[model samples]
Target: METKKYPIIVEQFHFDMVDPKTDTNQNVQVAMRQVEPSDPARKDELKSGNMFEIMVPFDVIPPQAGFRVSGKITRVVQTLDYFGQANEISPDDLEKLSRPLIEYIETLTYQVTAVALDKGYQLEFEASGNQKDNQ
Candidate 1:
């Protein structure tokens, strides 16, 4: 029997989601946003209750059963500008820019997928951590 788990794949990119009127990125338009550390460690700009909200795009469920759903970062590039001139990026800066994304990916351990089945789906999930603490 095929079982379903939380199939929601949430992939996030750090970007400033604001009205173009306020702050525009006309010069360097990127698919992903720049992740910055907040003053208070717990207060992440991507988290709720912040000036800029991180927009996550994912389907409610997968298209077919037994199909693999992936959340991967295809490309991460950084560019630095100096004296009205821009360069590709240095290895050090590239690593720095990709640090947060790398950390986020490390936390994934098949915990975020939620299967949508008629019943008995709960029993198939691996319950170890505070999975019951929040929900």
Candidate 2:
């Protein structure tokens, strides 16, 4: 089988799903999100909740890192300055756009900034982190 490996994969789960006879002791898996090397990192401004913005490569079943969130860009927000120059969304707006999907996205980025939103709300990416361990 040709299996591909990723730096991280995140899965959502439901602890409330109980099958009367099939299963009751397990939390049902609900949703899953995956990120390839194209994934972005957590922003420096948002790194206060992280350890030096080094998001790890791992998976979360229930998405625990979402108590507040790590950092990942789901939406790109653009703003304008007084000079008509383009500007990044204020921290307030960044948080506003990121808060809801933090669980799903941060899980993919692993709170690292290798891939993240930039000053223009565009995705800032580092080189692809995919590596071939089998080789």
Candidate 3:
């Protein structure tokens, strides 16, 4: 299958080199983004199931950093008013009635952590809460 590239800025990064040479512990900075599927075929996949996936660079922790990222975006029914009522919409049911316009997943808040890089490679990384953006 033909694939195109998209941008993915690492929102959170945490690395501890027990053995940076071979350990992947210091390399996985997977970030999740919520987006609407661009292709019709791709949209079908997400509609089939409310489940989604996380795309990763094929090389994974390459000599150079920053790679393209993409993933499936499934509908997530979130309550606008938590204390108002309990009438929540199930993801399955939402896809069933995909009408004139499809309801996309609405994301409010995100906790992104970013690590400083030294020429395409991670220099120093620290873990923090979802409160503020990491640098």
lDDT of each: 0.27, 0.26, 0.26
TM-scores of the models, in the order given: 0.25, 0.20, 0.20
Best by TM-score: 1
What would the per-residue lDDT of candidate 3 be over residues 19-51, giving only the tens digit for each residue? 224422222122223344667676654443232
Higher-ranked by TM-score: 1 or 2: 1
The lowest-lDDT stretch of 10 consecutive residues in candidate 2 is 23-32
lDDT of candidate 2 at residue 124, scale 0 to 100: 21
Which candidate has the highest lDDT of all?
Answer: 1
Task: Summarize candidate 1's per-residue lDDT along 1-135 as a digit string, tens digits.
Answer: 111111223354322123324421112111233433356774443233212112222111122222222244323222322111113334454344434433343233123334222221111111121111112
Clashes found in each candidate (C-alpha, N, C closer than 3 A): 8, 9, 3
Candidate 2's residue-wise lDDT over 82-102, tens digit each? 112112224453333334344
Which runs of model 2 end up more than 4 angstroms from their true locations?
A: 1-58, 63-73, 82-90, 103-135
